[model samples]
Target: MKKVLIMIGNIALYLGVFYALLYLLRSTYNYEATQNFAKFLDVNPAMFMVVLFTLITLVYLIIFRIKGWIWPQEDKNLFRAAGFRRLSASRVLLMIALGLAGSLFSIGLIVIDDIAKQFPSIPALVDDLIRGDSIWYVILGAGLIGPAFEEILFRGLIFRELRRVMPVYAALVLQAGAYAYFQPSAALSVISIGSGLIYGVLYLRTGSLWAPILVQNTAMSTIFLFKYIGFYEWFGRLGDIWLYIITALCLIALIGGSVYVWRTSGNGGIGEQANGSTKGGLTV
Candidate 1:
């Protein structure tokens, strides 16, 4: 509990610094003003994300080393202790495929939104991003930077720390909830929770942050591609029955693919303990 609290406090401090920097830059450079916050973000989403994530990564490294200085560890690899590790070629490919499957599962959220009429309208910022001038920025921010930072924060630090005090499943669910809430849209929040759970499971099975980060990038990139090409709109025009069937199939694929990836990726590798000890493996 103490560890969890400390971790939360550290995360809050980092977020505070990130937003402060963002506001400072916005005021200093005075990014082009717009009526919609979403439009403002779309104008240079890449610049904002690249700067934000770079700062977070730097802050994490500094604090990680500072903690080492305070405690004086013989081992200097705090990043690995936090779950950052190199992934095998096979695992990398499998993770990317799994990410595609996860995106398919996310599509079900659109169906749910249509049925419930509860999903918030897509933000203008997001709409603008899809149609924005700079494809490079979109690719950089959405495809790479966003996934890297989110995985580092949610999977690398938050989940790793929570697992120290609780069961892996409990930690996964708790972190998924937090991930869901962090989303910009309610519809995306619903989908993100599922994505987070799958990513958590992947991290647990591989004992590496790379798996989740890769999966997240692939999934997000696919979504962005669909949006850019109007594929989502075309798909939405399909008959209700077809949509239902596709949603059902996607759900099955998500579960089946997740389990297969877990088994193939070393059959549930041992989870890391807080003090860097090995523990009993978590199997499906």
Candidate 2:
């Protein structure tokens, strides 16, 4: 419980620092000035967040190193503790497949006209990015940087701590809940919980942070790509029967892919060492 409290405190501190940075930026330059700067750089205002988040991640890495979180001893690097390890080529392929299928499946669920109407509308930040002219910036920020940071924080840090004190399944659920709760809106929180679970499973099965990172990055990038290509609009235009058929196909693929990955992950159970532990005294 003490450890969990410390973990929660760290998360609070992290958020505090993030907002402090935002405040600093706001104090340093007015909104109009920042907009002008973004225009000068041929980017949108979202670039500020991209740069700010990148800095925060770097700062956290430095703090981890200084606190012996990354390199606790000569023999054991805590990067492995955070699920940074090599994966088999086959496992990598499976992870990619699951990630893609998961994204498609989630999209299929929300695109149903009834379901879409019931949920809260998309968050303004995401909507702005989708409508913005800077495609590459959105891809770099949302697709890559955002997922990397989230995987590190949620799966690498929070889930690691939870696993140390509870059952693997419980840890997965807790971490997913935490991740979902942090999202900006109810609709996103709903989507996040499902993705968070998939990401957690990927991390555990592959015994590598790269698994979730790759999966999440792929999922996000694909979403942006679909939006850029007007895929959602086109799909919406299709007849209801066709929409249902395609959604069903995506659902089948998602389930089949998840099962295939689980079975192929070998005899390791959810509580196996590969879930979040290293032989060299590293417990992720």
Question: What TM-score would every model get versus the actual structure?
Answer: 0.79, 0.79
lDDT of 1 by residue, 1-284 (tens): 68768767866866676677667655644444533554545477665687668776777678777777887863345466666655677778877887787665555445344653555343343454555567667778877888888887788777766776788789899989988888887777876788888888888887777778888788777767766776767877776778778777877776777787777766445374335643221222
TM-score of 2: 0.79
In candidate 2 the C-alpha lDDT for residue 226 amounts to 77
lDDT of 2 by residue, 1-284 (tens): 79678667766766676777667655545566575664633345445557767777666666666667554642233355466766667667766776677566556555667766676364244466555557787788777888877887788777877776678889999999999998887888987887788778777765678887877777777777777787778767876677778777866775676566666675563335544554422123
> Which residue ranges in model 2 land beyond 4 Å of their true spot?
25-35, 38-46, 69-79, 109-111, 123-126, 266-284
Candidate closest to the true structure, highest TM-score: 2
* CA-RMSD of model 1: 5.2
Candidate 2 residue pairs in backbone clash: 83-209
